[model samples]
Target: MKIDIVSVFPEYFDVLNLSLFGKAQAKGLVEVHAHNLRDWTHDVHHSVDDTPVGGGAGMVMKPEVWAECLDELLGLDSSTSESTTEVDDVSTDSTAAPVLIFPNPSAPLFTQRDATELSHADHLLFGCGRYEGYDARIPEYYRAQGVDVREYSIGDYVLNGGEVAVSVMLEAITRLLPGFMGNADSIVEESYTGANALLEHRQYTKPAQWRGISVPDVLLSGDHGKVDRFRRDEALARTNEIRPDLIERLDCASLDKADRKT
Candidate 1:
């Protein structure tokens, strides 16, 4: 997979080159790059924002700079503002056109479902807005051209910019990519995975018992069936106490007799 992020503070993504992402890049499992949005500016100040037309408190990002940056990344002529712009023939596979993403607090909440869906994209282009936010026309123009433009918010709160949001989203998507992790089963069993979407059960290791604390007896019984049952019960209890919303969405068919009692 290829990911391109256009942000004024490109240096903020330096951390992407470390840890799992760094290893993914080294193993050729994924490719990630950050481009300075100002590179597309033609003015001396390299400004990417302007005062809002409606007298807003903060300046809005300039659509022109974003257009130029996107054009360059998508292999279109940056100087043209024509709405017919399309991603250059990416590959023989028609699905290779890059999917554009805009992160905003007002957008639909990003979830594991979104992460799983995005992990399959051929390429992902992120538009990180700052100050007041993105010009409404930016996404409008792209959508008008039939481009895949999606806006997502990580949570309910607001952030100073989309850079941190992008970083978070990137981590979620990257970890699910094939060969990114040593244990593929981790993805299948981890918290928030589709129908079984519940907080992972508490885990313990090492001496099992410490300072009068002991691991669940079921875990030490060498009985896989009993161990699995204990974990499911713990996970259900945890989810019920924390995020009952997730439990409410579970299918009726998935609720066993024991689970229904819970």
Candidate 2:
């Protein structure tokens, strides 16, 4: 997949190119790019923000700069505002439209379900903001032009900027892409597998007996069928204790009679 990011603080992405995403790139599993938004600015100060119209406390991102940048990226310019706009490396696939998402604190929380869907994307573009926040209607502006603009948040609390959130999101989504990991089943068998639940089923390692405890006999028995039953119970019990809401959402009909009883 080819992913792009437009941000004023493009330098913040250095760590991405040297981490898991970096490895993904080295393996040719993904191509990630972070572009400076200012490169699309025309002002002497290379200004991309200004005071809000309603006398707000912080600056608002300029819609014009964003329009120009997006037009260049999407190759939709017919009497467009930019003179040097280039559509160089954006990938094209016969199967899908490009996805453009913005990271914001007020948007819906992302989940493993969303990550699974994003793993199939042919191209993705992330919009990162600084200062106070994005213009209230900036995302809408692009949406009006038929861009696949979506605003998503990491969680409830706010961070210094959306760059960190974008980084976190990118890592999560890209790692699920084909060929991105040593074992593709690795992600499937790990946390949030099959559903949006947190953490995989409990696991145990060597030394059947510890100081004052012992491994579940069902586990050591080497009976795959019994082991499966044992794990399902352990997972249900742990989840009920730590995050009951997840269990509440599980359809009783979805489980076998034994799982429902557990």
TM-score of each predicted structure versus truth: 0.89, 0.85
RMSD after CA superposition, every candidate: 3.8, 3.8
Alpha-carbon lDDT, every model: 0.85, 0.77
lDDT of 1 at 171: 90
lDDT of predicted model 2: 0.77
Query: In TM-score terms, which candidate is top?
Result: 1
> What are the per-residue Cα lDDT tens digits for candidate 2 across 122-238?
778888988877787778877887877878899889887789988888887887766667787746533454343633467789898999799888889989999988787787888
Which has the greatest lDDT? 1
Q: Give the backbone clash total of model 1.
A: 0
Error of 2 at 210 (Å): 4.5
lDDT of 1 by residue, 1-262 (tens): 8889999999999998899889988887777889999999999999999999979598999899999888778656655565654454243332566799999999999988888878778789999999989899999998887789999999988899999999999998888877888889637834466766888899999788899999989999999988988998998999999999988887677778888776
For model 2 the TM-score comes to 0.85
Lowest-scoring 10 consecutive residues by lDDT in candidate 2? 86-95
